[model samples]
Target: MNASAKRLVFLLLPVLATGCARTAVEPAMSRPDFVRGEPRVTVHRDHDDLLSAGLGLAGLAGTPVPFADPAHPTAPELRRRAIQASWKGIADLGPLGGYGQAYGAVPAVPGREYQAFAWVPGARQPHRVLLQVPDGFDQAKRCLVVTASSGSRGIYGAIALAGAWGLPRGCAVAYTDKGAGSGFFDYADDSGVALDGRRARRGEAELEFTPPPLSAGAGVAVKHLHSGDNPEADWGRHVLQAARFGLAMLDRAYPEQAPFTPQNTHIIATGLSNGGGAVLQAAGLDDAHLLAGVVALEPNVQLAGQGRPFYDYATEAAIWLPCALTDASFDATPFARAPMTRGWPQRCASLHAQGLLTAATPAAQAAQAYEHLRAAGWTDNAMQVAATTTAFDLWRAITAGYASAYLRRDAAHMPCGFRYAGMKADGQPGVADTATRAAWWSDSAGIPPGNGIGLLGGTDASTDPTLAGERCLRALWDGDGADSRALRAGIDATAARLPRTDLPLWVVHGADDGLLPTAFTSEPYVAWLRAEGRRPLYWKVPHAQHFDAFLPLPGFGERHLPLLPYGYAALDRLWAHLYEGAPWPTQSSTPKGQPRGARSLTPAMLGLGAN
Candidate 1:
């Protein structure tokens, strides 16, 4: 059958290839309906390839690759720099961090990368989907590993985790941003990120995002914050579309190996953090019976009405965690910067004024706040580790990004008086420079107070600068306003919607994960799954927590192990169970898996002897 005719056949009769066989008999080449336009395909060879964009393990470990011209970066330059930034953002590539020696590295896999924009059925915004098919892909024994970006990062966000493992194995790697990416729309410049990762004027190119117009100087618009899509609710659908796109592209890549469908190809979905949550959501929403298995690492998930929603706890932490961190016991928790933390005293005094704390001194108030945080479901270890995330202003940034998403609000009318602007040298909000605006697509992490985009407004005068906005955000959850109700409904919709499927599911979470506390997320969610008659494996690592990027900091490596190694091991076990019929590791039966104590990570840490 011809390519166009076969694509139509599959599009019209969706299930025509449900039982597609090894021997193709009129192959059902399904062309994904969500793919918006023709893919911009590029072949990478020699100095450039799938895993690292030509920068080898050593180069990726160093400084970020810079563009030849800041104002005009080509698709290849943006792609290269983004890949490097993503690697450093997600994994610990420090010399002693065990990337090349223990778990993963930039594997030299020559391949062709296909990039395209995919739209949800009725959504105006488009999320990016990229597929990498290595030259060594085994057509007969087909495999595809798919993932969504972990946090508010660009499309390359999870490449360090997924592509590093899959590409070397000759499996195609499918990635999607899941509606959260660094597609910044600078209202001041009247420009936005184009499909090729360049800054372009409104009508110059097909922009990745074009938020509601601002009144001349209201700053930039972040896709995650201003898309008005309630994207988290549709993360599962985005991932499913990513997989569908990968499958169709795979068919197109190798016409000789035609009829490659979900029924015939072994598809495994994996991701970390928000991406982790995305994969689990995909597992739940696999009503089409597409996914063969899922492996989620430190996933941000809540069982329907069972666990604390991210919005609830994240907003809570933004208000109280820093107040709690002033306690003496939190003196040194890896990466906490003392200068930035000095404002905690004023924050405590402000909370006291608001009747949130009733103590005589700031220290005493901090103790009270810590106790309050414990009451709100934070464990001692988790709160101690929360110092790292808190110091980086993670709680506030995450809440700001998600609040807009939940309310389906635009940048022009953000909730709680929040807005984004470029920061000048004097630390004031203004129009960012031409160079900074040009690099937004590759530099920003899809959140404000970063990459020249400063978060502004909410309170003109406050001792604690970000406190007022945080309080306003908390009030949204605590209040019964129409906007709050709408946001609440959106937050509630993020809970995994699942049907009964005993597909090979593996969940690996750090027991000491302070940001998404294991007690509030994985423990309860796993129990809920088992009660639903599905047996999913769960691994709770003792000395691990979120953010491997923190490992190179003073006490971090000594106290924690990287979750990437364990996550990689889980994928190994899942593949074995699927292809070799190997039994699921016995460690996961109990939520508390093998505990390698607070020491340096050894190769044996994953229970898989040396690499």
Candidate 2:
């Protein structure tokens, strides 16, 4: 980023800012109000109503209003219990890597403390596990809950969730690092358990690995899915092993204190995204009833075998993404909107000259483009940056289209980025480009966790990629090539293969989920469950984006999105039903507290306009 990048930003920021400037109220649905469709489900405000009352996405400023009954256990009481819990051994667990690019260092939870433990499946070196237990946590009343780390920042995901939700509930919680989040494992390494933690140039940083104080023998090889590369096992073997080990440790260490017994105490696997999928995989694969239930929050496709399927690597890399890049508008028909007009022509030309993009016919061009890009210099880093840019452009277009359709705003409110922001700038909103100033790079180099690279994992796109990619979808819909078969097999392998059991499973998705769309992530699993007659519970929250329930809303600074409170309540109900024979909680309310009931999920039912 030289003078040209600055000039480009100046020219583009105004246009991009236009997308955020339109203040008109758009219809919550994707379609027009006049369109006849299923009745929108009404949601009830049970235990999570306070979230909408000024809690920001970070939930930093305000104390969470006490949602629990005075008689029932409260978060504050549970937190107090956690604070007083015993701390026998503390070790240097080392640092979890930061998210790449513009995202800042992963924040440390105030109460979370790392414990030395050798549990993860693969490794020559020991891995530490983070554990927190409620003060009154007992085996008879409270079950040990193991959460999976979702993003590549490894343990950061665990820290965030545990601090925000789990530990507050007074239950025992634990998580181990999934190697993939840190980009530690080498795909090219053939020794099976090969991992390189040495720091290197821009795209390659040495991962930190501190062994547990006590040797747990040579660690097992983390499975493919957990690595977050090649999508092998849904949550990966490392997560599964770590989860099981966490449970076993809970049973052994807290047996007298709580129902941490293997046969009696219930263990639940829970998490978001990859962690969510890992729980599902654990439930399916653990034949010994290691985990009694699963609460999967918008799991990745590899875990559930759901969503709009991709065939080959080429399809995922090429046509699927390029279609969105070419979209001129965000209408239902996804017509090529502005590839040539926006900036793809010039960008593609530059890439072509650099041997990154080649001239090819329109037939199955995605694969061709992928080959060229890979042949040139597109590593995981480059591809992630490109994907983030494409996703942002597409989300803006879609948001503008919905606004224009319902609020009378023009769709072209923003200009796309001129160059791949690359390692210089993360796609996260508000991050400054370090490439523009060498001093800026040096200034951020000493930051924590990732030294400045925050939790901007690949899946955590600055914008959504669920919608576009029609060309790739259409092309691969009936695909039957060797690559397709291999890809499908890999996906299928990651899913739970054991016969469906009595273990309970619950899934929740926000209609306005911006990170991963319900149609692509959860719908397929819901359909499969229905077909299998598994009787799993699923909820779709209207006007709720990806972070609404889990993360505070960034747009509305201090106001919480509130969906997660409901999700937590639902989890409680699910737990009670499974463990205590209590009936499942059933109540619904709209964002306005209007009474409502669950309805079939449809494109119209989804709150596309809310994002």
| Top of the candidates by lDDT | 1
For candidate 2, give the lDDT. 0.36
TM-score of each: 0.92, 0.50
Candidates' C-alpha lDDT: 0.79, 0.36
User: What digit string (tens of lDDT, one per residue) describes model 2 on residues 31-74?
Assistant: 21211232111111221111111122232222222323322333
- Most TM-score-accurate candidate: 1
Score residue 421 of candidate 2 by CA lDDT. 13
